[model samples]
Target: MNRSIDIFDTTLRDGTQGEKVAFSAEDKLRIARQLDAFGINYIEGGWPGSNPRDMEFFELAADASFEHARIVAFGSTCRAGASPEEDRNLRLLVEAGTSVVCIFGKSWLLHVEKALQITAGQNLEIIRDSVGFLKQHGKEVIYDAEHFFDGYKSDPEYALSTLKAAEEAGADTVVLCDTNGGTLPHEISEIVAEVHKRVDIPVGIHAHNDCELGVANAMAAVRSGCTHVQGTVNGYGERCGNTNLCSLIPNLQLKQDYECIPDEKLEELTALSRFVSELANLNPDIRQPYVGRSAFAHKGGIHVSAVMKNEDTYEHVPPSRVGNSRRVLVSDLSGRSNISYKAEQLGIKLDKYGDNVSEIVQKLKELENKGYQFEAAEASFELLVKRMTGVWEEFFKLEGFRIIVEKNVSGSSRTEATLRIKVNDQAEHCAAEGNGPVHALDKALRKALHKFYPEISNMHLNDYKVRVLNEKDGTGADVRVLIDSAEHGKSWGTVGVSHNIIDASWQALTDSFGYYLAQKQKSIQQKEVI
Candidate 1:
């Protein structure tokens, strides 16, 4: 029989330790629901007693009926010389109303002596008492033996004693932590094997990524018979990071045939990873395994052609299995298949025997030589295709626009924008004032467009990115702007470029509204047929 492995997600606890990443109570709740939906075995929320936000999170999350995951409150073991009943943090962990409790205790003698200023025996008592108290309270206790690998190396007896204390005290799982994240994979396997021999209860592995071996070490521990893997989604944490469950879950289930996360919710992996990143206000790592933006994006001609013939030739796994899609990028390295694939995605019909593809491929190469990157600006590429194929119809025409910005000595700025636009034979002039010239321009443009197209009111910019083309001095750099907009749960992107930043933003902003309008038109036509 294959033993089950517990996937403990620390996104709320360790993932929040990432620089400038903090989830509000609402953010934590949203992530919790999503994690539960993804079939994670354990969700380790942050230390409730640490801050008001986390405290409120536990209070609100207490009523949540997680379908697959057990909510866990994380904190340190009760302080030395303190009763578990009297310790406020331990009490807070209990009162948080989670079915599971994870408490970290000092495993290294150096930490017992220096950090806690307690004797090794006193530290062991803290671990034993805390686990025993929580277990008595009918909570499944998980003792995270902090710095277990380093401590075991420093003084194997003391570290092993810590596990023995927690085990004897009734910890359901004793997790060994490489707290400093400096352990190698070989060292992890050797130490975990020894600890497995010493402990009777289930053993867990929690490796950090300071040496960038967190995932490797965690896998090695599993191979050595660890039944639980602890990590944050997307490898988020302080310093380097913890082991990444995004990579670990798939590796365990698909590669090692371990039953970690449920097989059905595997498709939610991509969305949940991105949703957590959005809640944290951090950009998702595009290169992350399974769910990353570039995980299945093909750029080279040979790779693209082969992927078109058989995706398994270039991809490790099918993207749809993880709620992601493969992308064939158009670059100088792209072949005819890449152009065809991209064209089809843009809703353009092309004959496989057509000669227009050669023209499109050559144009893509010419644009790439001119510093126009379609990989990052796919909207621009789509517009280029429409113009080349004469399939695009003009929805509105730009007459003229100008913006003025003034900065005063009082550290205040003012902007005035004016625009003239024509819809068919009708012309409209609009002006708006804003905090910045770009904002003012956007307001004026939308105000004018809303007069002719009421659907423009439903569109809002989701994200905007600006990049400089040249870094050399004394030369004006070309600016690129990518704009994301959404309406009715459908999102589309548009790109713009110019020597002026404001101009580039205006172009992208205009395209954002135009894309929505175009999509609405397509939907209406489809509805008419139905």
Candidate 2:
């Protein structure tokens, strides 16, 4: 029989513990539904007895519908010396109304004595009662052996005794947690294999990323025959965060043949990863593995050429399998093949062997050598391709513009800017004031085009980043400005460079606007055709 692994997502409970990773009750509900839609096996909603946010989240989740995942309430074992029925913590776990309850208890002898202030035997009793009480209440019980690997390393006999206690008490699955996240992969495999040898129950792994081996450790546990994987989407958690399920699930399904999700639903992994980060109001890490912006982005000239011939030459798997696509970056090292490939991606056709393709590649290299980078500014590259393909459209023409800065004696400053432009043979002059020169210039330019392209108002610059190209050049250092613009729900990036900061900002700003206009035009034309 083919092996199957259960994917347990803890983004709601453990992921919220990450620094600056707070989620409202509504945010938790939203994420829970997304996880469910992705066919996760289990969703640990939150600790019911911990806080109002978590308590209310469970109350809401109890009523909400989850198709593929069973909602699970997370908590610890009853307090020392407390009866299982009367312990407020355990009571809340039952009252949380989840069909499943996961409770973690002390495993290490040191933690039993120091953290719980209970005798070793009493700790075992706590484990036994906690799992048994939940099982008796007709709830599927999951027992997490907190600090299991470290405990196993410190006292193998005592750790095995804890697992034995939970298993004997009817715990459904025994989860070994690398609470400190300090165990190496081989150590985890060796220890887990030993526990599986002695215990007769399903095994699970929950790891943290303190040692940066969270995913590696989870995979190691699976390699050791553990059937359950617990992790947070995007690896959000306290300290260094927990295991990244985004990277682990694909590895299991594709390489290890573990079947974590249905083959069709596997592609939703990337969106699910980003959805969690978006709800947390955190900037998604573009370089994250598997589901990141740069995961399949090729910037090297040689790599892009090979990828064009055979995707397997540079990528491990088809990006479509994970809802991501291969990205070719245009830069100083780009060849004619890179230009042709990029043009094809942007819906432009070019001869595979053409003199114009070589000329465009040469021009892009010449510009990049003069401090222009198109890798992060795909909008500008598209515009460049259109120009090279002889299909470039001038949305508007810019006339000379100037800005004036005035400061008062009280140390307050004001910036004013004027812009002149022509749209469809009609000249438009506009002036605006702002808190800074760049802001003033941006407003002035937008005002000049708002009449010609009113939708430009909806396309606001979401982020602006500046990078100095030559700091050692001092006053003559060239600066590059990258602007990320958003209209409706779509976003595009554009770049510009110059010795003057304003000029660089304006160049990027202009490209951002032109990119938006070009996209709008294409969208309208497509609608008309359809």
Candidate 3:
């Protein structure tokens, strides 16, 4: 068997099935170029003849050139009792003009009888004719045996015959799919072993994550001699999701000694994952396996100390290997090493054993114990450290603020905010109204600050999320607010905690403005020196 596994990405096809996941033809084309740039083996454009966007994408991709990844057009086999030459779906696959085509056919006897209302033998004939038609047209056909595992368990003989029909019709590879995503990894290994014994064609695995076993089962298939793997970029698909190629590529190359994607391309995994999620208009799940933001976050004091001495003490692999960096999360649980690490990143030199490090650690612990979380709000954490170090300078000071919520004529609540602040010891008061209190505060604060610092007008508040800490207190619980802020083209997250929602949002909003101004000033100073 070939040691090199082929990575087949169906993000444009299957990934679009995910709820809230939609992509236009241009979006699909942009993603295809990125996948090819990263050296994916096969990029499944979409299922042609199903949607206009997919058909347009296939038409546009006909003239596009890919350096490493082959653009594959996907469709199902000819309909039951229909001739291959007359099947519209099969025709779309060939009209796509791609060198390779993937055609899925009924493997489960239940699906064949109930869904297609056809006899098992008739299903096999369509599989045979579909593969034969594509091959005769000079297209390399990959047969997807959909629901193969469930089919084998129900009727092993009937399932094997479907694959045999495709192989006889010149299909080069037969991909086994856990269509219902209910089979276990051990079951996948057993079924794949059985299939390899019955068919001479190479095997592949396409799995879903309903049981959270997509990656595990795909790995099991590889161990059982399958040479091709199918998945999406960030595990985007229907139900639970598809196998995450961001996690799969590293497992095959770094851990399993299999050459799947190139090393340099593998390093771009983190960026690629973020790009896809960004295009989907969804926030990245920072806890995802290899490419997540919090994948290597350290919170325990002992763990931080051990990691500083030797990263292997806590890390499974060098995070930089996949373009992700280790993060030292400072909280009430952190130690001196955590403080030292964060300070280093901030470009603030602190002696590892100095009083400054000890003081900062103790202060952080005290504040965190009082409900100040710095992990998600590094900007506020930096400001705290600067204050403790006595190097902090205030750009502005809040005199006071007020917000009023009243019913409008339409019975909807309207929020009005008044902000008073002093910059250079000069007082400025501003007022604004919004649909909500937080929005009112955001507008009022920026209005007051923009007078002193016009550059702050470039800052935009992106996302605001709130979590109640003491739910036992019910409506009186303390709330934690996390704000994602963007300036120019860069973005960062900051956090705040308070009993009042307005107070929590105000603190986070202030920290966001503070961070934005500080970064802007640093850039200007750097340019002057340059």
Candidate 4:
């Protein structure tokens, strides 16, 4: 077996079928270039006949040069009664102008009988005709056997016959698809092994994630005899999802000793996953394997200690291998080791605070027991460490603050906030209006501090979330507010907890400002010392 496998990315086509997933023709081009740069073998642009947007992408991609990947247009085979020349779908595939074309044909008897309303022989004829037609146009054809797994289980002979039809018709590759995504890994391995025996051409696998086994099934197929694997980045597709190339690539290259892409390009996997998710306008799954924010994050004290000593103790592979970093998170479960690890990560010297590290752990535990979570609020945790070390200085002293919310007769609302603060014995007072109370407070505080510390103006709150600690307390429940503030391209998270939501927001808001100012001062001092 040639250990080298062909990777086909369907993110632009199948991925867009996912709910809330939308991409423009330009976005598809951008993604196609990225995939090419990563050395993917095939890029399925979209079903050109299905939409004008897909055709637009294909037309735009015509002029683009890719070093590795061949852009492929996807569509279905000719209609049962229609000849390949008269088929609009096949015509669009040719018009797509790509060197390679992929077309799916009915394999399941259920779809042939009910969906297509065609006889079994007719389905086979269309499959053969469609592949032959694309081949006649000087295009390499990849025939997708839709619902192959279920179809094989239902009628093994007929399913094998369909593969034979496409293969005999000069299809470059025949892909078996788990269209409904319900097949087991063992079944995939068995079926793929059988198909490889019956077909001389290379076998491929395209598995969906309905049963959360898409990646597993793809692995099985490869173990059997598959050389081409089809998937989407981050598993973005209809219903559950498609096989996640993000997960599969690493598993194949690092674990299974398969060559999916260039060895050096393996490290770019995490970055590519995040890039696609960003372009797709979807939040990256923090828990996703290999590419997620939390993939290598350690929170338990023992785990952190072991990982710090020997990362391989707790991690399956070095996170850096995938363009990801290992993170030591501080929470109530953290011990002195966790604090030491985190301080080292932040470049904070803890040698002077030797015994004080224990106190820091105690304080962290106490705070977390009171509805304070440091997992997402590393900025707040850093400040806590600075304060415990007696190296933090008070940036400002709050005197008083008040907020007023008024509703008008036309269902309109207005909010205003006023605040007083002392900056090095200089009393500053200011007032500002905003759409919400938190926004008003943020505006007013910046207004008061802009003169003493104009750098505060550079930072703004980008995200805010409030979680009620106890719903049993209802209106009086304690709330934990997390605020994400960004300065230029950099960002940090701060957190605060209190009985009143407004107070909680105020605490997080203040911490966010305080963290930025402190970091700015440290940076300036470092430059001065140098």
Which structure among the candidates has the greatest TM-score?
4
Q: Per-residue alpha-carbon lDDT of model 2 for 1-530, expressed as tens digits?
A: 25889999999999999999999999999999998899899999889999999999998997898889999999999999888998999999999999999999988999999988889999999899989999999999999999998898899999999999999999999999999999999998899889888999999999999999999999999999899999999999989999999999998898877789888998998998888888999989999988899999988889988998899998999999999878888888788768888998888878743677878888998889878889888999999888877888889888878999999999999899998888898898999999898899989988888877898888888899999999999888999899999977789998889999999998999889888988889989999999
Evaluate model 1: give its TM-score.
Answer: 0.92
Better of 3 and 4 by TM-score: 4
Candidate number achieving the greatest lDDT relative to the actual structure: 4
Report the number of clashing residue pairs per model. Answer: 0, 0, 0, 0
For all candidates in order, the CA lDDT equals 0.86, 0.91, 0.90, 0.94
Which 10 residues in a row give candidate 1 its minimum summed lDDT?
466-475
Candidate 1 vs 3: which has more lDDT: 3
Q: Write the per-residue lDDT of candidate 3 for residues 393-421, one digit (tens) a residue.
A: 87888999999999878987879999999
Off by over 4 Å in 4: 526-530
Candidate 2 off by > 4 Å? none
| Per-residue lDDT of candidate 1, residues 388-469 (tens digit) | 7888776788999988888899988889999998988799899999888777988998888886788888877677788787
Give the Cα-based TM-score of candidate 2 against the true structure: 0.97
Query: What is the alpha-carbon lDDT of model 1 when measured against the actual structure?
Result: 0.86
User: Against the true structure, what is every candidate's RMSD?
Assistant: 2.5, 1.6, 2.2, 1.4
Q: Superposing every Cα of model 1 onto the true structure, what RMSD results?
A: 2.5
Q: Can you rank all candidates by TM-score, best first?
A: 4, 2, 3, 1
